[model samples]
Target: MTPHNELRLLPWSGPDGKPCFLSTDNTNGHLSRLADNTEAIQLDLATELLDYASVLLNGAETDSEELRALATDLTEALRDTLRVAESRGHRLPPPHTDTHADDTDSPTLPAAAFG
Candidate 1:
């Protein structure tokens, strides 16, 4: 696990390995922000941020408590920023999801080929 400050400098990647911003400052930034507030809302926000970081780090094959916390905080900030942008008419592309062609609708191969 990192000391939390260094974790902020780490980059977060989406499921598609694209970059995403998580915090305005390094891990220290997140710590500093949290230090100023201890409300339930802030704690909840922290949890949400941590969850996002876990997903990002897991996608990039990295995991740690500090990384997770930092990532989560960054993720929350990103989400809020996006929400504000959307409210103002800025749109973001949705996260990528695997969409398989309808193989069930395609003609099936002959079963006799295996026999």
Candidate 2:
């Protein structure tokens, strides 16, 4: 187990396009460096997706196929973003509603919560 402050959680997609988290305490290690690189790429992709979504929302062609494609991309990007937030404990409910008493008792994310 890793202390919350020491662990660096990097969000990424597997080869099959599934969300995955790489945890590391060594911020300067080789794998950690890779995680940093991967995070950059994912962020870029997310930005591109957002730009496209804006275009669609602001009156683009309304073909069903095109809409479906954009919807799929949007879902993927949002899921990636949420996974990143979840790993950082940023999206949890308020403390009053939280069941866990401390950091050590935090609930684990289900595999399906990823891509």
Candidate 3:
């Protein structure tokens, strides 16, 4: 059995907007394939929406109703994209950490660097 941390985050939600997860060792299984395809479709749709939004926004005669609809669609697409990112992030291998480094040996960056 896969560990809890290793469980796959499914692309779709469950009842009441709860997240859904899949626990399996087979990457090529039916559910995995389905989720993969769904993610691909979602990404494609988001790309197409970006193009449409650019065109719509560039038009001088754009209407309020059309802008509102575009905003709604963009919101949904952003949500899906975030979910996909979270799912894939969890699946990535944990970053390597060094425990033996001396505190004094660490380099410090200026506060302005962060900005």
Candidate 4:
């Protein structure tokens, strides 16, 4: 069994909207593969939605009703994408840091880099 902190965060929620986790040493296990496939599908759908949104927003005759629906879909996609990101992030190895270096010595990106 893996340590509590090292458990894999599954891509979906449990009953009553609680988070679900998996603990296994095998990377190619059944649940791991399922999570991987689900994440891929979610990301692909989000990408498709983004393209559709761009086209819809650029149209002159787009109606308020359609925009509201699009907003709802986008919100759901964003939520799923965030969950997938959190799950995968937990599975990544920890970053290495130098003990001799001060926090101020660390590199930083400009604000524009985020955009």
Candidate 5:
């Protein structure tokens, strides 16, 4: 039997927005179930966000508040999805590099590079 100190993925953030890991060895324990439920809710929220976006787009007019709320929901859902991916052992790719650019030279449009 495994000990209770085994680390398990957290379902949500703590009071200060940090991930909270639970130390438990049971595969079917309460914390494990909670994590699974959280992951499912996150994925479902993402799907709901897409549906809401489509509805908003189809409407004749949209208020700024509605748009802002949608954006917030989208961001939270994305973060949750990323957490799920991390728990599954997936990682983000390295930042893209410009092979033509030199190491010592600064980017051409430093102030407006992103655009």
Candidate 6:
């Protein structure tokens, strides 16, 4: 089990040694008693998709109302998905060995705005 400030990443290996991920943290304590971890992974994918959509919207030359609406929909969907995951006792994955982590247990984001 890997834990971040408020996020935790738990990787589970199947009988065949294949791997998958689970999230366990304050926001997802409800899922701690659940028997499966698929719900969390699904929510993570939805979040990732929303991230991509954010990038697309940010880089677009024309932020049409349709695009804005689509982005809003995706954001709302992501929020709902996260809520469900939490209700199911799951959470978003904690930062792994990725550069996102500051090589410490403290909170670290993608940038170093303040010390």
Best by lDDT: 3
Candidate 2, residues 8-82: lDDT per residue as tens digits?
Answer: 455765798765555555667898778657667777899999997788878855888888998998888887777
Cα lDDT tens digits, model 5, 1-115, are: 4432356557588899887887655768887888888889889989988898999979989999999998998898888888887765422334456654466434356666676
Best by TM-score: 3
Residue 21 of model 2 has an lDDT of: 56
- Arranged by lDDT with the best first, the candidates are 3, 4, 5, 2, 6, 1
Model 5 earns a TM-score of 0.65
lDDT of each: 0.48, 0.69, 0.88, 0.85, 0.75, 0.55
Q: What are the per-model C-alpha RMSD values against the true structure?
A: 18.1, 11.5, 5.2, 5.8, 10.4, 13.6
lDDT of 2 at 75: 89
Global CA lDDT of candidate 1, please? Answer: 0.48
TM-score of predicted model 6?
0.32
| Local lDDT at 89 for model 3 | 81
TM-score of each: 0.25, 0.58, 0.79, 0.78, 0.65, 0.32
Question: Where is model 4 poorest over a 10-residue stretch in terms of lDDT?
Answer: 96-105
Number of the candidate with higher TM-score, 3 or 6: 3
Better of 5 and 6 by TM-score: 5
lDDT by residue for model 3 (68-110), tens: 9999999999999999999988887766555545646456668
Of 1 and 4, the candidate ahead on lDDT is: 4
Question: How far in Å is the alpha carbon of 76 misplaced in model 6?
Answer: 4.5
